[model samples]
Target: MELSDIRKEIDTIDEQLLPLFMKRMDCAKKVAEVKKRDGTPVFNPVREQEILDRISAKAGEYGGAARIVYNTIMSESRALQHSLLGAGKDLRQRISAAPKAPRRTTNVACLGGAGSYSHDVLQALYPQAEPSFFSRFSDIFRCVEQRQADLAVIPVENSSAGSVSEVYGLLMQYCFSIIAAKTLGVHHCLASRTGRIADIRCVRSKDIALMQCSQRLATLQLPLSEISSTSAAAELAEKDVGIAAVCSESAAQQHGLKILEPDIQNADNNATRFVVISKEMCIPDDAQKISLCFNVAHTTGSLNSVLSRFAAAGMNLTKIESRPIEGKDFEYDFYLDFTGNVHDPKVLELLCSLEDELPRFHFLGNYCEMK
Candidate 1:
């Protein structure tokens, strides 16, 4: 057959395929109704696996390609069933019903002391709020969980050193909701009471800060001490003439230490992203970003299948990271951030589908992004 004739036949096949696809989806809707009535879950992994195996066996030499096609079809069918059954609707409703604006007066929790980056970002994001400082990140979460603070500001990731994994683990442990997020540029400064670099014999700061300024610290040949935070290190430097702190300029100023060198970090464009977590969930009117985490089956292409859902819905994913599941040797939990508001029907449908189809899933938050 001529190439043009073959193309015409392919087009005809697609036209026939569309109606069959619709009919299959209609049957899926009926299956959803029966499952809803029987209080059955939307996803049946064992049955899905059986169907795929049967189809692939019948497909002969094209088994692999056939499995891929059937997987897409089944995934769509599952998503449709989830939406029809109103899966995840309650959480979506709660998110949509949350307060549109944060309270004018709020108590906030932050890691480190008065002049750390978390403190600066918290002040910038919530200028009027009262700030309670903590030495450990866990304490920040605890403060919000116990209602001692209305919200907790914690660093989620750093542009220079990648994610703060401890915070991610704490997030899984805590029950608080992330209500807001902001990114702040970081500029490390070397501060001392003597106001002279020559007087410094040792440097102190948070371990991450020390690492961030390793190139400069190596040149100084100073012994590094790991303190709880940059602000704490600055406070230490204020009491000792020979001790210098690797911290923010604001911290040195707050602690009455003179900055001998500024912007000493290895990278000139270093920044840290912070998330504001509260006991209650809230989705503001201007919210345009969402964060979620989920686990897929250990089978091949499981993760890609989940990601394809977002792509098919025209959602733009901003970030994706995988962390190993605590007890499982090779299994991982994927954390994802994508552009879409909870009010968008496509976004809601995707979330509902994932919640129903995935073995483990969590809707971390929907919030506005600030740079």
Candidate 2:
């Protein structure tokens, strides 16, 4: 047969499959009604696995491909059930009960001293708020938890270095909600009190900053030392002779150090994303994004099944990151960022189903995305 004839036949098959798919989805909706009446959860992993096994066995040579297709179909069916049954009604109500707008005046906590990137972003996000600086990331969380600060600004990820694994771990430990997020362009500079690169014998900065500027530091042949933050490094460089710091220009200027070399980072377009976390949940009117953390069962296809929930809802997943669960050998917790407001019925249903089905799940927050 000619290629065109084959294509026509495939099109005809698709037309026939459309009604059958709709019929299956209608049956799924009915199943959801019965489940709701019986107080049964929408997700049934054991049954899903059984169906997958049966279909794969029937497909024989095409078992792998068949499993993929059926998996997707099953996921869609679950999503339809969730929507029909209003899966996340409680969660949706909770989110809707939150304040419509964030407080105008608040106390904010951020890592590093004056003029640091965290400080700069915090200032931009909450200009009228009181700011407290901390030496450690955990300290920021502690301040918020203790009610000493109303919100905390944290560097969650760097575009060049990937996700800050330590920050993710801290997030898992803390019960704070992420109310907002911002990204700042990063430019590293080598600064010193001497105002000359020739007199510098050592360099100091945060470990991540030092790594970002490794190539330039190596070229200058200076020994690198890790400090609590770039702001602290600037302070050290200002007080000690024969020492230089790799930090933001603002930080160097704040500490009265002269810039010896600017834009020293290996990547020209380096940037870091910061999250504003608060003790109370607040969903703004313009909020269009959500962050989530979850852990799936250890069974086969468990992770895929969880992720399929999002795809089934037609939600766009902007980011998905995994961090090892503490003391759990090979187990991991996943962090997900997706584009959707919790107020959307479909999105809320998906979230509700995830909360019900996953071993562990957290709705980090619903917030606006700022670049």
TM-score of each: 0.91, 0.95
Q: What is the clash tally of candidate 2?
A: 0
Candidate 2 lDDT over residue span 1-371, tens digit each: 99999999999999999999999999998999899899998888889899999999999999988998898888888877877777666677778788965664478889888988999999998898888999998888888888888888999888887788888888878857889999999999999998987788899999889888888888887788999899999999989878899999999999999999999998999999999998888998789889999998877677887787777678899999898888898899999999998778777888887776678988899999899
Cα distance off (Å), candidate 1, residue 27: 2.7
Clashes of each: 0, 0
Task: Give candidate 1 regions above 4 Å deviation.
Answer: 1-16, 58-62, 103-105
lDDT of 1 by residue, 1-371 (tens): 99999999999999999999999999999999999899998888889889889989999999989888888888888888888888887677777678876553378889888999999999998898989999999888877778888888999898888888888877766646778899999999999998998898899999888888999899988799999899999999999999999999999999999989999999999998999887788888889989888889998668867887887789999998888888998998888899999888888988987886788888888898898
Error of 2 at 160 (Å): 1.7
| Pairs of colliding residues, candidate 1 | none
The Cα error of candidate 1 at residue 323, in Å, is 2.8
Q: What is the C-alpha RMSD of each candidate to the true structure, in Å?
A: 2.3, 1.6
The window of 10 residues in a row where model 2 has the poorest summed lDDT is 100-109
